[model samples]
Target: MLKELDPLLHSQLRLGVMSLLMGAESAEFTFLKEKTNATAGNLSVQLDKLSEAGYITIEKTFRGKKPLTRCRITRKGIKAFEEYVQALKGYIK
Candidate 1:
């Protein structure tokens, strides 16, 4: 039997976010939006979902006078992403 994939990370946008975060120390909302080509509303929703699951952390602060949002994957997220990859690989074999 094939292993089950993580439904949360299964989303294209969500997976893209995770992949990007995996490579960087952190990423900003604007960068994620540009990279994923996702709308602000949609990206905010996905980020909330990931944060709710403890897969990522969202930090809100001011960059000078402008509000800035930054995202970083948690250790839990790294492990989950790795497992998700392994589970997906099971399907190809």
Candidate 2:
């Protein structure tokens, strides 16, 4: 049987976010939006879901006059991503 995939990370947008986070210290809302080509509303919702799961942390602050939202992956997220990759290997015949 195929190993179960992580429902949260299984999403194209969410997976993209996690993948990008894995490469950087943190990522900004607009950067993720542009890279994922996702709407602000949809990205916000997905970010909230990831935050609720404790996989990532969201920090909100004002950068000068503009609101800044940055996301950082947590240890839990790294572990989950690693496991997800391992599970995916099961699909290869």
Candidate 3:
């Protein structure tokens, strides 16, 4: 039997976010929106889901007068993503 995929990361948008974060310390909301080409509302919802799962951290601050939102994957998130990849490999092989 194939291992189950993580439902949260299974989402296309969520997966995309994880993939991007895997390579960076963190990412800005605008950057993610641009890279994913997702609308603000949709991206915000997905980010909230990831945050709620403790897979990622969402920080809100001000950059000179502008509100800034940055997202960073936690150690738990990295581990989960790795496990998800291993499970996917089981399906391929």
User: Against the unseen true structure, what C-alpha lDDT does each candidate score?
Assistant: 0.98, 0.95, 0.97
Per-prediction count of colliding residue pairs?
0, 0, 0
lDDT of 3 by residue, 3-90 (tens): 9999999999999999999999999999999999999999999999999999999999999999999999999999999999999999
Instruction: Name every residue pair that clashes in candidate 1.
Output: none
lDDT of 1 by residue, 4-72 (tens): 999999999999999999999999999999999999999999999999999999999999999999999
TM-score of each: 0.98, 0.96, 0.97
The all-Cα superposition gives candidate 1 an RMSD in Å to the true structure of: 0.5
Q: Which regions in candidate 2 have their CA more than 4 angstroms from the true location?
A: none
Ranking by TM-score: 1, 3, 2
Model 3 poorest 10 in a row by lDDT = 47-56
Q: lDDT by residue for model 2 over 31-79, one digit each (tens)? A: 9999999999999999999999999999999999999999999999999
| Better structure of 2 and 3 per lDDT | 3
Instruction: List candidate 3 segments past 4 Å from native.
Output: none
What TM-score, to 2 decimals, does candidate 1 have? Answer: 0.98
On the 0 to 100 scale, the lDDT of residue 42 in model 3 is 99
Better of 1 and 3 by lDDT: 1
